[model samples]
Target chain A: METDKIHRWHDMGGQPAGEIKREEHDFALWEKRVDALQVLTSGKGYFTVDGLRRVLEDMGEEAFETMSYYERWVQSVNQNLLEAGVYTIAELAERMEQVQARGETYGECAGSGE
Target chain B: MPHDHHDHSHDTDGLSPSGHPYRPDQDHKLTRWQAMEIAMRELLVEKGIVTAAEITETVEQMDRRSPADGAKVVARAWVDPSFKARLLENGTEAIRELGIEPGVLKLIAVENTARTHNVVVCTLCSCYPRNLLGLPPDWYKQRAYRSRVVKTPRKVLAEFGLELPESTQVRVHDSTADMRYLVVPARPEGTEGLDEAALAELVSRDAMIGVATARHP
Candidate 1:
């Protein structure tokens, strides 16, 4: 039994458009920023729109099906940054740890002008 | 494009421990990618590729866009026959006449008729006409919507409180590329005297998405 038969993204092909529950929610502050971040970076020529789309399309099945739309975009932007050698993996990990250790949310830390 | 090598073995589907989806127990917080996005923005600014002010300006730019813009376009199409002809022919060019930049995306305005209804979806990665319409609704980007909207549009339209007559043919436009779509909803009955602004008020984002018709005034 081949358990993982088809990729979730590929499986979306030709599926009937059906009655999906319409549940709209306000976007989180960070979510809104992520949208802008993608646009800003792309606007600066760090990556093309098609390149960003390709990055999104190439996301793994598990992540694709599970992560929220903007989450995927954030990840895509990160991947693009790393690929462009903006910073090394070690630096990214170190910064992430520093951000986590602040004991306050991103909003708080950024609000304090840190 | 370099692939994301980051591991995501702990990604949850916003499910509760009891197995219900969209549980409210999950408080509003930044997901890992969101945190990373903030970090990336800082890094990009540090690299001199883009400035914080630029990012702020871009955020403001995106914030300024809303469905109200699309409603105005649809409303004008409903009242002005010449505008409607132009919108149906070249959506990108037509929208520019109203000071709206169609941008890089190829926008195609599909008309809804007594016999035909149109809905737009991008099965691949939530490709939407963000220039014409602001950021898509949350539901539009979900896997359930991206997957189902193409195959069972009639059922989906009904879910949006829009049940078309059996004689009305539903057409689902799969936006597979740079070409984005906007469904010009049919002008509702009994509003022949409404001004463009009043008519625009009747058109909702759902109507322009072809999920529902304009509300009767």
Candidate 2:
């Protein structure tokens, strides 16, 4: 069908790959928070699901290989928010720094915000 | 502090009730992505962009959506010819009639027959009908399944332990954009005596995904 020339990295249909891994895990609390952020922000019109998909695709195959599903999603959500001007890089960087200093564990870090 | 009261120490050394290894608890060391999530969420709240209550509500709503919802739809279609017609004609509206919201995406219900089988994949990305079926399984979002399902559906289905006869034609639906698919597996033999609820019990998540058939119970 001559589709090879046009296929992007994320457009993986028909590409040869390894066997499917059947193992599954329940989501972590933080992962659920990431999912919630994606839904809530997009629901509030900060970005569309298309915008989220665009960033995830643009992240390239390396990210697909390395990041867990919600990890990549959180990154994409953050990027979309940046593009939407919900917050600036400076604010994010400073907030991240502050978040890092609060605690070494997610429960500790996430608790201080509320 | 909110999560401090729960005790996860009991499951730390063993598989969870679901028989899968426990995912690391929140007490585990935070990663960079975790930090990013916390920062992003707090920032949005600080700016009054979205309230904390809204995020919690949204997550709860998503948690409420599971394969059982899709199973109910499939079972209803199996028992009622008219509902089956409505579901095949307009999946979103038909599901809505059962009080299940499909969000903004178009839903397409593909019926499996003696000669035709249907399976779905998202070759572009993991575009699942999460509003109807909860989150997709991890395998569905993997590169292998996404890449191979469209090209070699029979082989993929075989991996899922479903072997269709050589005469059966496999139709693969790629969720490339706005549409999502649900496969209504044909009723298993001897299920004629079962009511809707009992039939629903036979519909597993993979069955609706077309990786497997409704189990013979």
Candidate 3:
């Protein structure tokens, strides 16, 4: 039996009054890449669009509300990849460490590539 | 290993800001999640699960789509009654006729009228019609929009500078699961002479999302 684990603000029933901020669709370079990565993975049959939705739906209400749009996409991709056994959590954590270390010394080792 | 392997310690209690907060200073750097995604993507390509060319090609394909596609479709519907009827009946089919593929997800066109207004929201996640409208704007993905829009449709719309009459029923469409919704706002008056392309110019992305109406001539 499937259950709704997380209770999000959007999950609330009935009407409430509030403000909505409006902005242009100016995607940062990383955001654009993440969007493309999502569609590409889905297109490659690595995961279905529905699969991504399930990951998003499973997120805690707080995380869902607080994270930016592409952040949510990144979370979904990470969850999907792990579920698909493309990479292990230990492997991902180690890789993150490596990247962080590289990023720290990138300025000295090589130009920041500005 | 069991699925619980990935469920290792993640501090969900940490309030990473109260809402959808974007970093303007770190524009050049990638977020932690973005870096993870990059690492995973590279690993996948390294493992021969997918290819860089495939991802690049897909990105190019997505880039080709923009609000202009939706604008063109909306503009044509304003001038041609039969096309409007088709759009209302079958969004995917209607869009396909215009050479714009609606992609895998189903698109349902909701028409806004004097008596009723329509808006789209995905409470669970941001499931937009990217095949036609390109990427969703920053605000649409925020907690402020997602959490509020579904609950207070009229109030939220009002905040966006769209106030409805007391009698008008504001219908908020929660885009769940497979189907996506696109709101076809009622054409504004005083532009009967405008051609299709000219009429398209009047349709903004906000109008298609039902936050505002078409710009009047």
Candidate 4:
């Protein structure tokens, strides 16, 4: 009877999986920036860590398999920020367009243009 | 463009300034998510919610926290019985004695003895004590580690080269919610004369995660 309960994709305890890949990589600048943004925004009471996790879980299993760690985090953080009314979706879309128009590379787009 | 005037001749064979191999981010084409990150950060700063300096400071603070902090606590517990007792009783408060702020994390320090071994995993997501022991490792966030660690801890531990005896019990702690786990692995033998600082050297990140025992020095 306990097995009949509907299990969510995010609740992945005791699931069958492959061998653990023992590789490790250093955090990229963009990844670290995403992490920093989450910490700063959460600390300022915009959203809790649980709020972020909720959005991440709602993203579905396809996202988990396709997107990288920070990619999902950026999406979750953006969703939480939008839900909190930190900024409008239109404003975010405009900003993202401006960022993409800056250059083809991350270093070119991420600068403050000082 | 801001980068137009900068010199591009300082080559380090694709390594970043921190000596790690550069992730394909800066030189590679901008991704949708990277654009989103830059956009969101800029928007937040423009709206006066968080300053650029504060974001930088937060990243620096997180970077400063490492397994070394957890190692110090384990080392102290190895040397002081009262501290060990206090740590097992109340991990959050006991860690504060060493000046480590766990923030709102409800830490539960699990001890490994001759009869029992403890391991930790976050089945839902990667909920680690980043305040005390830095970010969770790459494997820790992977599906294999999260899914199988709870179901077959012995097989998982064996994958990490830790072969426990049949008599010893393996207790897997699932960090499904707020409470985080820190495994205080049994100290290695023949190190009774070592001081706390020296003892700290033997405690690696894997040991504290319960995937492997503390390194023998």
Candidates 1 and 2: which is better by TM-score? 2
- For candidate 4, give the lDDT of residue B170: 94
Residue A14 of model 4 has an lDDT of: 86
What is the iRMSD of the candidate numbered 4?
1.8
- Candidate 4 Cα errors over 4 Å, as ranges: A1-5, B1-22
Measured against the true structure, the TM-scores of the candidates, in listed sequence, are 0.85, 0.93, 0.80, 0.92
lDDT of each: 0.75, 0.89, 0.74, 0.89
Q: Is candidate 1 or candidate 3 better by DockQ?
A: 1
The candidate maximizing DockQ is 2
DockQ scores for all predicted structures: 0.31, 0.72, 0.25, 0.65
Comparing only chain B with the true structure, the TM-scores of all models are 0.84, 0.91, 0.83, 0.90
* Model 2 chain B poorest ten-residue lDDT run: B18-27
**What C-alpha lDDT, on a 0 to 100 scale, does residue B149 get in candidate 3?**
83
Residue pairs with backbone atoms closer than 3 Å in model 1 (clashes): A16-B151, A16-B152, A17-B148, A17-B149, A17-B150, A17-B151, A17-B152, A18-B148
Query: With candidate 1 superimposed using the best TM-score fit, by how many Å does residue B37's alpha carbon deviate from the native?
Result: 1.9
Q: DockQ of candidate 4?
A: 0.65
Q: Which ten residues in a row have the lowest lDDT in candidate 1 chain B?
A: B17-26
User: How do the residues A26-93 of candidate 4 rate in per-residue lDDT, one tens digit apiece?
Assistant: 78878989999998999899999889999999999899999889999999999999999999999999
How accurate is chain B of model 4, given as a TM-score from 0 to 1? Answer: 0.90
Candidate 3 residue-wise lDDT at B106: 85
Q: Worst ten-residue run, lDDT, model 1 chain A?
A: A105-114
Candidate 3 lDDT by residue in tens digits, B1-217? 5545354335332212323233452334545765675666667677887787876676677767778989999998999999999999999899998998887778899998999999988765676877768878767766677777877778788888999999989888888668888889888889889999999999888899999998998
